[model samples]
Target: MAGKLQVGLLFGGKSVEHEISLRSARNVYQHLDRSYFNPVLIGITKKGNWHLLEDIDQSIDSAPPLNLSLGHSRHTFPTVDQQGGTGLLDVIFPVLHGTDGEDGSIQGMLQSVNIPFAGSGVLGSSVAMDKLISKQLLKDAGIPTSKFIDLTGQDISKVSYEQIENILGLPFMVKPISLGSSVGISKVSSEQEYLKAIEESLQYDQGLLAEQYISGRELECAILGNTVPRASDPGEIIVSSKYEFYTYDAKYKDPHAVEIKVPAVLDHLIVEQIKDLSLRAYKVLRCEDFARVDLFLKDNQTIYINEINTIPGFTNSSMFPSLWAQHGISYSELITKILHLATERFESKKQLTRDYSGN
Candidate 1:
């Protein structure tokens, strides 16, 4: 392919959603325009190992090999189609989710290698991945969000029962600050389940957040941009059962457990409001390329910004691409737009003065 952009798709990680990442990557890999992109499948195993998959179709036939020390690897990871000669990566598409992938770890590695990557930078990714910090940033930006208090593992373990109840209150959501895909997240209706929930949450992250559960419809908006960002139509998550909330299984495994309704049922004014707020949150967080802004729309029409996912899920079922699809942007077009934004952002960052010039 002449003049084709070589895209290195990095997926899978040392996270609970590693399997989901594989599914997402494979779907994207197969759909990417071969004419415009030389799609390279760079698989990262669950144990955090990175390997260049020679034949993606054949590799899919076998179980993925685990890479326990991806972070400790010495030689630079080879790009796809490097069998005959060295393959230089033009841009990296990180389709990974949760923990090491979405928590700014992978982004940092890409930065160190001096490779252009899609999505937010280190600060934006790390900030958006942590629920506690994201909420604080939204609040600082004058955006309404659920009431929350940061609690570390040590703090949760040592806090007196009365103190925990007094601060967190009842019917609160205990979440691991840095994890996504609903892992290590629990909703507690009373103090009796507080300790156990906190203990479970600590298994995922050191920092935790106890947030007042704002009852409302779960809404999400997709944002795409280089400098000026555009927000997509809002989508809603509808749960069939009267469960506590959207859990891990309901999100990926159980299809009947939840339904994702695009252009979510809402007043035209409310839809506009949600879309506008989503773009605002994206700018405040300094998210580049793309992001999915999730929010809680209360019955009283009060909109509370939830968290933003810098590297949100990219499968067909994912709200980010799906929302854009509803706005007449097809999946292939969405990918094209994101790649263009990545190049645009990389070029913009190159404009900064790196070497100091003495007057």
Candidate 2:
């Protein structure tokens, strides 16, 4: 490759979904087109250590987070690239799934250094990560989402399972407020399940989301773009009878646990409605680059917004890339387009800044 852009492929994090991140990163790395770009593998360990891999197959090791000196000039690291000397990175493509990576931490770090990266910015990342906040905003925007209440501090201590059963009803979903990959999520239909669910959820986050369980088909829509985002044909997740819901095991552990149908079978009008709702939810969250919006389609032809993933999974079986593939964009083409979008957004922002010296 000659004069190719260096893409820093980042993945892994200090989150419950660390293993899932690794799978996504590896898939993304493999699918990345080497002709147009040179992949710089930057894997982070579960303990939050950043490593510059010599090759794609390099394993992660433990260390502390990078200590950067934020001076006046642009912050640049030495010997971080593949070559011995300093080489400017064109863009960073993060496959990190949850917590520090997806929840605005990494986004903020990139933004602080004025580096171009794929996916949503800090505000969108943080808002979409917390289910409690997202539900409120979606409801305010007139988007139909299941009713839910946040349990934090006094609410966490005072609220009882009986109260939730009465308010939302039996068979509600209990989730860690800011997590993904179905980690620390439980569909509770009993007091026993509720207690265990909350305790398990608290292990992941200080807050919990007790959402009403809407009985419907599970659908997901993958969105792409910044100003005028487009939604892919909706996909359906059919969880087998073995699992009560799409649990972590159903998502990653057991391949036979669920069936995923891209461009999910539906009427033409229903597909349009799903696309409209997904776009609305994406814009409401101020999502940029791309995201995956989940929804619940009730039998009455009504739909409810579930949640949005800012940095969705890029694994071989992930619905995001799979949904776009149906639209004729292969895995390599989709990522290449995403990186171009990242650079485009970065350049546009830089031009928008006029030296405000007169005023």
* Highest TM-score model number: 2
Residues 186-279, candidate 1, lDDT per residue (tens digit)? 9987667877888899888889888888888999989999577899879999876666798898888787888899989899999899988999
Q: Which stretches of candidate 2 lie above 4 Å from their native place?
A: 62-87, 354-358
Query: Please, what is the TM-score per model?
Result: 0.91, 0.94
* Overall lDDT per candidate, in order of appearance: 0.82, 0.86
The candidate scoring highest on lDDT is: 2
User: Where is model 1 more than 4 Å wrong at Cα?
Assistant: 57-85
Which 10-residue window of candidate 2 scores lowest in summed lDDT?
75-84
Give each model's clash number: 1, 0
Please provide, for model 2 over 1-359, each residue's C-alpha lDDT reduced to its tens digit, 9 standing for 90 to 100.
Answer: 25777888888888888888888888889998888988877788888878777666667763223333343354332223323334356788878988999999999988877778999999999999989889999999999999897887579778888888889987899998998888889999998888898899988889888999998899999999987888999999999999988888988889899899987999899999999999999999988999999999999989999999998889888999999999999999999989888878988898886667875
